[model samples]
Target: MFKHLLPRLRERSIAAKRPVSLADMMEEFWREPFASLAPVFRDGGYPAVDVSETEGVVTVRAELPGLEPADVSISVENDALILRGEKKFEGEEKKDDYHRIERAYGSFSRLIPLPGKVKEAEAKARFDKGVLTVTLPRDAAEAARNIPIEGA
Candidate 1:
């Protein structure tokens, strides 16, 4: 039960857009019958995303601090951009707890909806300064075009 749930809970909470408290979590644990199976969003999500479309391309920038290229994976599947990665907490030693511990480490996955058709083989990804930028070149046929306003 809890053995498999803790990880999921942590991931969901981290993915949440707003902060969730311990009491809230406890209340959810007791009241929500589907809590275990539900996706929870608490706040301070991982790998925050910024997406934009311009110049025949869709750009996705995700912040992945403390992660290496090998720790992340990006792929295109059926008009969707999938991002998968894991953030590990390296080393744990006994420490005096007088303050606060807020950093979270775990696996995260986000599926972004594509703005247009993309050439998967022509896509490019680069990682620098803990940020992963993926650019998907849009298909020529699917590129956006401006419509000139015609006054009659």
Candidate 2:
């Protein structure tokens, strides 16, 4: 989606040796069928994620509609949470029999960085109702420390 477009836009801007304007966008994908498909090309990809933090835990939820728990893989590396998975559709007939193909089916990997630090060892994850939730407990030393205020 928008995530995939930003990098291409930045690269195009760099290669053009100037800033990208609205007119530039029009001219870049300027063609007969290509021009018509300009918008689709810019917006196409996987689901989005929501992250929240409580006093002791950081939770990550990713939208993965139409997928089973086994279809996705989650891991942690350094300060980043890694998600790897594929969205696939199969039929008893064949792949070419489809009349229309709108849904994206392929492998994707997304790395989300933690807000601060967490105890990866104690992290837990669960997938249910097409939502993947990961709860990461804040590292003991990295947890917020409250300081007492004194009257001067």
Candidate 3:
């Protein structure tokens, strides 16, 4: 159904272009807000992330391909987890045989807020197989404060 409708839509667009009025141009402009935002999406940035919590600990995993351990930094401050990294495209700088290029480069930072205070000293991070994982242990006292209240 959509395949047959597409040609009619294109024909209508062509006919509509004949005497483009101010209202028609305004309608076209309002219809596509992302056309001017293509450059922002093209910039390689912000690696994907996944976070999980178990018991008193939270584990965060991020996918960072083509990045080394030294290129990444993790920090926690005021219950906020911060992950920052820079991905550099490293290959021979030759002027030949380049088909397509679609990878993000430069620095990206992701900050995740924890629900409660965590044990900073027990936090650990490891990177393996292009995946970075951080383990955060919650503070024992804060983790045990949620006692169920009985009906009065």
Which candidate has the highest lDDT of all? 1
Per-model lDDT: 0.82, 0.80, 0.78
lDDT by residue for model 2 (50-88), tens:
889988899999999888888998888888888899888
Residue 63, candidate 1: C-alpha displacement in angstroms: 0.7
Sort by lDDT, top down from the best? 1, 2, 3
What order do candidates take by TM-score, descending?
Answer: 3, 1, 2
Model 1 segments beyond 4 Å from truth?
A: 1-45, 95-100, 144-152
List, residue by residue over 1-152, the lDDT tens digit for candidate 1.
Answer: 65566666666677884325564477567876565663455333456889998878899999898999999999999899988999898777678553756677888988888987999999999999999999999999877689999999
Among all candidates shown, the one with the greatest TM-score: 3
RMSD of 1: 11.5
- Which candidate would rank higher by lDDT, 1 or 3? 1
TM-score of each: 0.63, 0.63, 0.65
Query: Candidate 3 on 42-145: residue-level lDDT in tens?
Result: 45326677878887788888888878899999999878888887787777568878787766567788787777888888989999999999999988787646
Q: List clashing residue pairs in candidate 3.
A: 44-104
**Colliding pairs, model 1:** 16-41, 16-42, 18-42
